[model samples]
Target: MPRRRQAVTIRHVAADAGVSLQTVSRVINKEPNVRPEMMERVQASIAKLGYVPSIAAQRMAGSRSYLIVALNDRERTIAGWRNREGTDWVDQMLLGGMLTCAEHGYRLLVELVDTHNDHIARELLGAIAAIRPDGVILTPPHSDNPHITQLLEAQGISFARIGSVKPGAGFAVAMDDAGAARLATDHLIALGHRRIGFIAGPNEYELSGRRVDGWRAAMAAADLPTDHLLEQGDFGLASGRAATLALLDGPVSPTAIIASSDQMALATLELARERGLEVPADLSIVSFDDTPIVRFVHPSLTAVVQPIADVTAHAISLVIAEQAGQSPSTAPVIVPATMAVRASTGAPGAARPGGGEAQGYAGPPAGAGIVTEVSSDH
Candidate 1:
């Protein structure tokens, strides 16, 4: 008869390794406090017996596993984004949440709703209820949605927004879009480019409107009339190219164009080349959200630097603070932007005679646009 196979148990491993059951547990669970040599022995015994740890048994032991959930809406576009494997806005939010959860000894779970889903807000709320996480994080424009906001409130769940909501809304860590755009526009004006053109990002994007507002405000302050010189983009390089093409082909071509994002700005350069226009010589340009790639472009981009790290950190802090029973400020914390001027701008030049020639350009380039830098305010 074959020798009887020995049963594998935590006690057997501990005894074989000349240690206590708790020591075996410490080694098995990969927890702290086990002596190195003893841990090795326990592992050797377990290997000798071919022992396997039961996940169900571990869960049944009343061990706590903390988790947090994040909800995002990608229906609108985010500026300064180059779609690689994992650098998008949604990924940033998830990583930020993970960092926050790690600080508090918790896990982060992310759920992405379908862009075409109509009842997304409702479905998201249901997921939250089922998961029952310690807390949740919301990213714009979802954070700005009133219906979703009301639903979260009704459920009595705690959450924080990664971007700004309305003035009276609570718990937001966001960049000041209008302020930053103002700075970008101002940089161009100071550089002497009076025939400035504005390229708007996605219409549905909240920041797009804010940036345009800043552009308009700056122009208005400078006593400049903005009419028919603005074109919209879908926050893609292709959109930027098309918008710029349209602007250049029109009768009154602007000497400088301010793209809402860097990808769009780069696209503007490509279009300018195709149209036989030289950057900073014939047509200066500026873009927003200074991504790393901007510096590597043929003409290093003149941009509005957005602090991604700060925004992420602030959002994490807000969510954790909300979970700790400390309420975040009702006012959104606005991060400042900076003017990273490079080779894309210069002084204004003579506009094509009779500004009416540029009838369809949407807005005029007359005033200073707001530019902001990163900040750490609650």
Candidate 2:
């Protein structure tokens, strides 16, 4: 290897521009009262020398750290990365936030904080001390936690809540979880599925409950019976497996199922196979999250896409803009979720009553579990 290239610094820019360090600092920070000619000359020197200021340098004026911190649940995030499961949300969020932050000359930092820890305030306090970030983005449980929001508010820091609809403080960014579920449930109803089972994620997540509400809303609207058709999962494989078992083995088996997470959907698929049931034939499955893996699974999953990246990017913009005195509205940003129709869902497998022609999306006969045909008003 030849000589290692030396990193360019602000000092180099000042020297190249034949100006004092204070002048260069003001120019870099865009302080008021700097003559246009002087600012232009310093900027030219900075461009020519390819001088990139470090975060430490950027914070020398003590106004901003130029970093946006996003907090996620430590346990789940670690497990997701370790297991390589359907955990595309974090990756998508980071990608969108980082890219959007770059446009504002800010950096993104992802901090994992345990949701169950009683010392959450202490943990957040440590982060504030170490990074002194200008803003924060709270995800999932943290988003709905009053403790986290209160702490950030007391610190006078701008923040955004993802997947939260709670009132007060911070920017609230969320997807229409209920609407997404209703759309999925309607799809099944339109396919002549009367007894549709819903696999809900943990209640600790507000979004999970909203999805349940959506399913119930749709079923009630269609005048369908929901008895023994609802079960709870933890957005994990085991919980999904157990929920699927309960739904299938109950008094009345569902003609179709909607799972709140991709992993749970996979478990449903596995259980269906174990029961000698073919997808779209014996049991139709609709998965939530729609992670990259869902598309590649055997008999690809029909899924609800959460638009995680877009939501995250919007959150970043709101937080940054608030810090810049833009005063973005506190009203929740409702980015709607959409469905990806795939191979995993179709008409109930059992033949329609009296052999009526199957309606909705075309697919092979689902199997022998037919339900009464009803006009779907949803």
- Model 1 per-residue lDDT tens digits across residues 39-68: 888889999978876544444553422556
Which candidate leads in TM-score? 2
RMSD to the true structure for each prediction, in A, is: 9.8, 5.9
Q: Write down the worst ten-residue block by lDDT for model 1.
A: 355-364
TM agreement with the true structure for every prediction: 0.69, 0.84
Off by over 4 Å in 2: 1-49, 350-378
- What would the per-residue lDDT of candidate 2 be over residues 1-378, giving only the tens digit for each residue? 799899998788988999888888777655557889899999999899888877787788568888999999999999988987746889889988999998777899999999889898898999999999999999998898888899999999999999988788899998888888998898889888998999998878989988999999999999998889999999999999999999999998997999999999999999999999878767889988888888777777888888788899999999888766567788999887778777677787655445343234443344433222211122
